[model samples]
Target: MNEELLKMLNAINSKKEEAKKLVMEDKIEEAKTAKDELIKLQNKFDIAKDLFDQQEKSKDEEIKNKVKKLTVEDEEKKGHNAFVNVFTAGVLKKAVNEEDVKIYNQMTEADPTEGVSDGGLTVPQDIRTQVKELRRSLDALEPFINVEPVTTLSGSRVIEVNADQVPFDNVDEAAQFPDVDTPKFKNISYKVVKKGGILKVTRELLQDSAENILSYLTNWIGKKARVTRNFLILNELDSSFGGDKTKTLNNFDSFKDIFNVVLDPSIAISSSVLTNQDGFNWLDKQKDSDGKYILQPNPVNATQKLLFGRYPVAVVSNKVLKSAVEGAPEAPTGYKYPFYMGDLKEAITIFDRESLSIEFSNEAGDLWGKDLTGAKVRERLDIKTIDTEAVVKGEVSVTV
Candidate 1:
């Protein structure tokens, strides 16, 4: 839009210059004609300029309008600033090892626990934020999942399907008409799942070292959650939802052939491809008759790779989409590399009930005998396949 406006403005300036040149050359009649055309162009330019100005806004101003305002209380509750005192202000007196005590202070300063009375610590907000950011960056399946932060732990999403009533080929000019199709709705529920692990840290390490233990712990837990969530998403995508076997692509074919089977023509152009490393490797090696690579760089995001110059590609781990093995006749050959393609935004939904939560216990049975403190991190989330038909799955094996 901005580029178009700039071109229009340049044209207007050029016309004005031509009109001025005509007047300077003493061509009175020609100048009048030029000025007349200039006036008309100016009118159109004025309308376009007004529209352009209205549409263009400072990026900072736009960001400010979209982002929620932070209050003083919220600011105060943010990072190390909030937890520094809670963990360092004579909180852990029982841990006698000075080295362990130093490590604990460093951890607390990084991510302070809310209540230190029961030897349990509430992870700081900044640590949680950092962990989530890291997880999003590292998680391969994150790009393809539709994430929604919901207040409730469990809720239902309604998927609407319109009846496939054929359009009338011919009808009387004044004849009565009926409804084209009835809409059908399918209700799918999302139920949160809880996952957490307890880890023991020695008192010496907690008190002695200057390492950012909180960041390390939060990152570990965040990655663990991402792995678990990706596995669940893969399972949901592979499930026999609605028994729509037509959406499956079990054999190798041309891009158009496979894409047509997996996605509707109307929504096929801007889609996504999710598969294992083997699947992407095969796609990356594909070429046209001229030997040009079939896959292209995504225009929307320069950092991303696109399939056939259209769909973005995400390569999941073999655990989610099994890798292929060649030269073994006895081994499984069919669907070894599961490939899923479609508008995942319309198919898969992830509901986050709560952000990540971290809790610590000094007296946990698992760590009590070992003189270590236990930390557990958990999050509440769920995945749902909103539209089974919108997503297509297939298997392809290609050697590169």
Candidate 2:
């Protein structure tokens, strides 16, 4: 636009210079003609300038409107309205005025699926965020299990697994085989169990302090489920398949024996380790020839705690992997720290039938009379040992 305007100005200056030259030559008629041409050029330039100015003004107005729309003040106003709609209008059923109540009632009527009277509001996104943030209080045990979602609550799933191949001598191609060997498989049955807790809260707290109450209860229930399931898995491994591929370590030097057992060619070596903090601290002190710690960060994935840079290690709480007296049958005196190392997912499989679900009700049997609301959260999951040989469990004496 500026270039076009410059061209017009240059044309006008050229016409004026021509007019002056004509006047100096005493050609009055030609000079007057040049002046008229200059006037016409000036008029065109003025029209173009006016159009450019109008275009610039419109562009400035558009930019100002966009900036106003995107301002933090506008966003804050929207947030305030959202908060009011969720908390006051929806949950508490309150209205700032008659106009807001009408709007809120209309919104409620439009979406019949919201609120406890309906199927229960999808547990507000903000409340869910609070739940997740609080869930970090529990120990991180998600990596130990390969979770799968299933629609059926109870059913049997067929799993085809490769067994250790039998050894055979070389035979001629034309010779008939003695016997055929095929891979073995077993049926894995899954059943969902209802695991949850009911929390009673006063009406005042529900209306005024929903966030804090939800966070606390969700954390409590989550911890219970996680800790309970983790221990069940560890206990089942010890009770049901303890004697399979066992390795009892008497000294720190023999720690490699457990690793070798897991990494043995006969079984899958892609594994993780689970032990109490005491066991982890013991392994943490083990040094190489260069006097460096053996428990180094995993090279493949930096987030994992690798043992000898080979296997990921998860520190189960002492409550689950408890210290017990384990020696020879004749003399069971020394304190033994239990450790599990192997293909964790293959060894102990967790079958989840449903995700964690929560519901709130103000009208329960006793809660209604007591004027309290009940928040209940539950999940469906069960654990079973899939392949005993895939994992190896051992105990190390703390005295050693």
Candidate 1 off by > 4 Å: 1-117, 121-125, 163-181, 208-211, 240-254, 299-303, 317-321, 324-335, 362-366, 398-400
How many residue pairs clash (N, CA or C atoms closer than 3 angstroms) in each of the candidate models, in the order given? 15, 0
Tens-digit lDDT string for candidate 2 (298-389): 77777667876667888867765776765765676567777877777776776766455456566778987987767666667777777766
Each model's TM-score, in the order given? 0.63, 0.60
Per-residue lDDT of candidate 1, residues 1-400 (tens digit): 5777678778878888988998899988998998888888788878987876766656656766656455443443433433433333323434323443344445445333334544445554556677667667654576676888898878887766633434544566897775555567788888888877765666654564233645556667777767777777767876733234523333335456757654676557657787777777777887878999888887778877987667788876666567546656575444345667778877788888656554566665757787776666678888887766677666555443
**What is the C-alpha local distance difference test score of each model?**
0.64, 0.66
TM-score of 1: 0.63
Superposed Cα deviation of residue 280, candidate 1 (Å):
1.8
Error of 1 at 30 (Å): 49
Candidate 2 residues lying further than 4 Å off, grouped into runs, are 1-138, 163-180, 209-218, 243-246, 262-268, 288-292, 297-305, 325-334, 359-372
CA lDDT, candidate 2, residue 287: 84
lDDT of 2: 0.66
